[model samples]
Target: MSTAIFRFYEELNDFIAPERRRCEFTCVLARAATAKHMIEALGVPHTEVELVLVNGESVGFERVLDDGDRVAVYPKFESLDVSPLLRVREHPLRVTRFVADAHLGGLARLLRMAGFDTLYDNHFADDEIERLAGVERRIVLTRDRELLKRRTITHGCYVRALKPPQQLREVVDRLDLAGSAQPFTRCLTCNAPLRAIAKADVVERLPPAVREQHTRFSTCDVCRRVYWEGSHWLRMRALLETLGC
Candidate 1:
């Protein structure tokens, strides 16, 4: 058996057991193993790892483990630039589109409300989410660590927050999306961009009071749902304000 000491940094430690978190721990490799497999075996998905160092030298996931080697792993650096070093993924996702798993319905709605291009269906299977994320280049947001471990999923995140509201804050802060928030610009239900429409065109669909009181309106291009600056809109704005977005 070969042994190596592993240290996970920052949020990467969240995946480890309480005893192993925030410190170096020895991993006994039964046989020859790649860094990727060994790291996943320790509960940290390779997707969440931005950098891996073997004995102070930058190495890729395919690096072969050796006895007495020291390994260090790090989470994605949102602010700090590690351009001079090697990153596990080919490139960072510049456009912040997202695909939420079945369990993240409320978080998906919140993302759409913030005007992000979020694709979500409660019936989406794990494989389907992986395929969509890989083919469409959408970042997968899920609570399942194993889902992020799929080799096909190049971009994904493990949502640490439990509540939908807290999850929204977590995602926003993690993605640095506060400046990009365009509230009321997307369909909360359909994930389609909202377009300004003439109040006269959608008047028949609106309630009598809404038609009489609200002149400005927007409609979802896909769902055709009408929206106006009503009480709900005001309440949503208040929510956004509370979120600092």
Candidate 2:
């Protein structure tokens, strides 16, 4: 057995025991335990960890824990430059696509409104979500810590906020998504990229007021839904502006 001192920083404390939070605590470990094993053993999903240090030296999750070792685990560094440190994942996902769990439908739509490729289906099961995320190389956005803990999920985030708008803000800040956001470019209902359509092409489907007043429009390639810069669009745009995207 090995005894190691562990300290988790920032929001990571949310996953640990109240007595162990924001302070060093001793953990008894099996001989040759890896940092990954120890971290998951404490209930913090490995996907949420951006960097880990053992004895003040940067190390990967597979690094072996030693007796009296001091382990400091940190969540994703939104503003900090830790390129010199050892990160668990080899590289970040470039496209930033996401698959939200069944419960985060509101957030999924909001993400779509922000022009992110967000996949959301109210019927998506945990297994389906996991499989889709892996195949599509999508970042899992979910509130279920247990789901995020799965080994197959190499990239994911546990959303901390409760309300949809707050959750969107949290994700935007945590993932540094504001800069990448391209608002109103995706179909909110189906998650498809919208292509500009000639007003004449969709004019028959538009409401009388929309047909007379609106000359610009876009449509979902997947669901064939028409989109226009109407009152709803203005309202949604205002909301996204408040989020600074």
> Best candidate per TM-score, number?
2
Question: Model 2, 1-245: lDDT tens per residue?
Answer: 67999999999999999999999999998778999999999989999999999999989888999899999999988678999877888898878999999889999999999999999998999999999989999999999999998889999989989999899999998888888999989999999899999998998899999889999999999999999999999998888898889
Clashing pairs for model 1 are none
Query: Ten residues in a row with the worst lDDT in model 2?
Result: 77-86
Per-residue error for 108 in candidate 1, Å, reads: 0.3
For residue 195, what is the lDDT in candidate 1?
93
After superposition on all C-alphas, the RMSD of every candidate to the true structure, in Å, is 1.5, 1.1
TM-score of each: 0.94, 0.97
Candidate 1 weakest lDDT stretch, 10 residues: 87-96
The list of candidate 2 runs beyond 4 A from truth reads none
User: Candidate 1: which stretches are off by over 4 Å?
Assistant: none
What's the residue-level lDDT of 189 in candidate 1? 89
On the 0 to 100 scale, the lDDT of residue 80 in model 2 is: 85
Model 1, residue 167: distance off in Å is 0.6
What tens-digit string does per-residue lDDT give for candidate 1 at 1-245?
78999999999988989999999999897588989999999999888899999999989988999999999999978889888998888787878899999999999998899889999999999999998998889999999999999988888889999998899999888877899899999999899899999988998999999978989999998888999999988987887888788
TM-score of model 2 relative to the true fold?
0.97
Q: How close to the true structure is residue 224 of candidate 1, measured as C-alpha lDDT?
A: 89
TM-score of structure candidate 1: 0.94
